[model samples]
Target: MKTWKVLWRVMMVLCVCVFTVNIVSYPQPEVTEVLSKYGSRSEEVRQIQTKLKQWGYYFGSVDGIYGTQTQDAVIKFQKKNGLRVDGIAGPETLAAIGISSSSGSSGSTGASTSDVNLLARTISAEARGEPYSGQVAVGAVILNRVEHPSFPDTIAGVIYQPGAFSCLNDGQFDQPVAESAYRAARDALNGVDPSGGAIYYYNPVTATNEWIRSRPIINTIGQHVFCM
Candidate 1:
């Protein structure tokens, strides 16, 4: 009886050791970072909606609710910005939209450094020989297209839209950007509308497209004509 009791106690101890080992070796589930996904309701969502609306990505009412409309807008923004099209406002997406995820507030309303550079490059390519205001007018037309319902809702989108800009195909876009183009881009981003809210512009002397020539002219800057 004594031996049996001792053996039973030893087995119990071994069983307890095995159980502890199992507990220690078992894989824990990965902790997923919480993100503003569909159905989430908060001020962050409202900010996201506001930014999207301002950038012409979202058309829904800013009600702070993450519904289908918000998700679809997020997807559209993501696709336009070359982000993962998950439709969830994750940290990356929030940062891309110029919003702080931790504070739930917006960052600077100005264009990012990359945006400025792109706009400058485009201005340099399209209007390097024109006056300073003319270069800014070109940038303004690009920004106007971003806000227009008929064009893509982002600068890069509008600039790179197939057959949108002739410079993209004529090798001028790849040339060194002019120094004044940078200032012009910044001025245009800062709400300077030398284009007079025009969504289109072209050099009448070089433009051969009849469709573009038919656009109602808004203003003339240097060699280019700004149009609606």
Candidate 2:
């Protein structure tokens, strides 16, 4: 009996250590993320986190911050070759990011005439060939901007605002839609609002526009900083 107790204790200790490693390696998500992921907070959010943990995609306390672990896991997957990581997701992320949650709708609708395609066209106009989740995020930022009263009321107007997106200024927005922009656009329109409600976004890492520094930041994601 004593040997069995010792064995049991050893197993418990090992389990604890493994759990600790996972928690430490991954940051927890913020509370709002939890609410958004499940489309409404309830016992189901906990269940989603539990599943995320099981899949090595969530590391935060099950208390539901949707914290760093979730973000890092999301970032890690996005960083991998050929993966799009917007942190928040739709079908693409659901299928590829190794995490899944219902967005309160029946997911996206009509693959042929879907918002995803509309989003794709919009993204093509704005970001064109920009790579990966950053481009997707940029598209989301523009949409977020459109939602704000301070910006234009439509995607075309905001993007076409003089010197807003250089691509638009240089006539790229009028060009044929590219595949990457389509993916990013689709992801954004699918309810993956990664910018939350940011009204402006810029790449400080590459930007030479001095005026962008004046805007107050609402959040940062990938390589872009979003502001009000």
Candidate 3:
């Protein structure tokens, strides 16, 4: 009887292990279409912002960069339109937004190219060697500041604000932007707030500002501690 009980317990343990593995291995929904966020600077994203703004959804500038305000607008639109509330401009979401793939909406470069370049430069300067998500986190912080009362209202204004970022003061912002930086900027603009809506971030090892450190921490990504 003891031997039988031992075998049954082992079987139960094995079953639990298998179940856990299956849960962990479950596939998540793949984001196959354009994922616009807070710092994304593309024509397609601009169109979404413009349409959403016209329809009383978005209220921010239509500068082709996705930001927190744009994300909120997209979510409201998606929720109201009975579409998936993921806030991503996937095929179905775009179609519902009155933008056909064949229409090639928001594709024109126009003058928004400068905004993209500027954001890419900022990301590259601040998070050159960080992980891709970390770079996005850096961009998200910039966008968060734009929406915050204490910070500037625009991307350029936030980035160029006096004594805002050390990279700008140290001439790191002048370096050529990296391709990864552009991707990271787009990710952040696409509403990927990996820092959980953080408005500030700093490396714990290098951060000397006691005030910044005193703020409530949100999360740590790469080498930076994101703060609310």
Candidate of highest TM-score: 1
- After superposition of all CA atoms, the RMSD between model 1 and the true structure is 10.8
lDDT string, candidate 1, 47-70, tens digits:
899888876778999999999999
After superposition, candidate 2 runs with Cα above 4 Å error: 1-122, 125-131, 174-176
Each model's RMSD to truth, in Å?
10.8, 18.6, 18.4
Candidate 2's TM-score: 0.42
lDDT of 2 by residue, 1-228 (tens): 999999999999999999999989897865654322423344544544555565455677776444556556555544431345555444444433222344422344423232344445556765544456666777777777767777755453454355566763566645677877766776776656666666677778888878887889877766678776
For each candidate, how many residue pairs have backbone atoms clashing (under 3 Å)? 0, 14, 13
| lDDT at position 14, candidate 1 | 100
lDDT of 3 by residue, 1-228 (tens): 999999999999999999999999999989654556657789989888877776667788988887788888888866654457886776556655645443222223221333455677889999989988899999999888978999756565677566788886687876777899987777777677888999999999999999999999999988999998
Tell me the lDDT of model 2 at 189. 62
Q: In terms of lDDT, which candidate is strongest?
A: 1
Worst 10 residues of 1 by lDDT: 101-110
Pairs in steric clash, model 1: none
Q: What local lDDT does model 1 show for residue 202?
A: 84
